[model samples]
Target: MSLAFSERARAEIDRLLARYPTRGAATLPVLRVAEREFGGIDDDVMVLVADTLDLSPAQVRGVFSFYTHLRRPGWGKYVLQVCATLSCALRGCEGLADHLEARLGIRAGQTTPDRRFTLLKVECLARCGESPVLQVNDDMYVNVTPAKADAILESLP
Candidate 1:
């Protein structure tokens, strides 16, 4: 019944647990470890994480499903989350999104056939002043235009 979490992940969980007073307080970090180890918090990972934290799988699932940073199955290597919040929307985020769809040949919430990218239309990325922002993996690009977005995509290795 082991989730086969790697030793590194176990060590990270232990470190994370030490910083929190209760296992429940460490839930997010634990799930993050699981996500890194398993590539996504699928059903099995949820059960195993619950077992490790002495919580129910349903509880783990609730938390896991709530966060967008957590990867789900089929998420591409590069996850491009375009901000669709009010600030970005007012600054032509919709048009940028449309441009992305046309350029990538895939709509939002879908991955390219090559599995290189997944375009997601997400809410605010907390960069309101820098409207029309999108995050590719850990990097955020602000004030992006269609041409700039295309150049960004082309620059990804």
Candidate 2:
């Protein structure tokens, strides 16, 4: 199997490559495009990127493995990343996480049966001030209580 980049994605990669001195430096940016475009980076996608950039598969794989943002498999539309670091934990992240899991009927690292949501436990979202925070997709919700989280999840389509 091979991965193909859309014209728009290729253009974006070209624009990013121009800012970097070396093609290897463009790896992360290219991976970002691939992630947004294809949803995630599987082995085939990595190989395709290698072919597109004239880099070795190892090089492409290296970048993919190094980045936590890039998933090896596809993910649901909604990614609920709960902060599980010291600060968030102290603020009751564990209870928040449990509430989400029970309400969503899905455990951490698992997607809902309907494939509408994926619950994940992340180290930190850099919102220490917010303490108990959870990132839904690209948006961060700070100091989320169980009730607020339920309301937020219910609001999703």
Scored against the true structure, residue 134 in model 2 reaches a CA lDDT of 86
Model 1, residue 112: distance off in Å is 0.7
lDDT of 1 by residue, 1-157 (tens): 7557888888899899999999988999998888888887788988999988999988988888766678887889999999998999999999999999998899999999989999999877999998899899889999999999999999999
Best by TM-score: 1
lDDT of 2 by residue, 1-157 (tens): 6457988998899999899998887888888888888878888888888887789999999877754456545577788989999999999999999998999898999998777888999876788998799889878899899999988888978
- Judge candidate 1 at residue 55 and give its lDDT: 94
Mark the regions of model 2 whose C-alpha exceeds 4 Å error after superposition: 50-68, 71-73
Top lDDT prediction, candidate number: 1
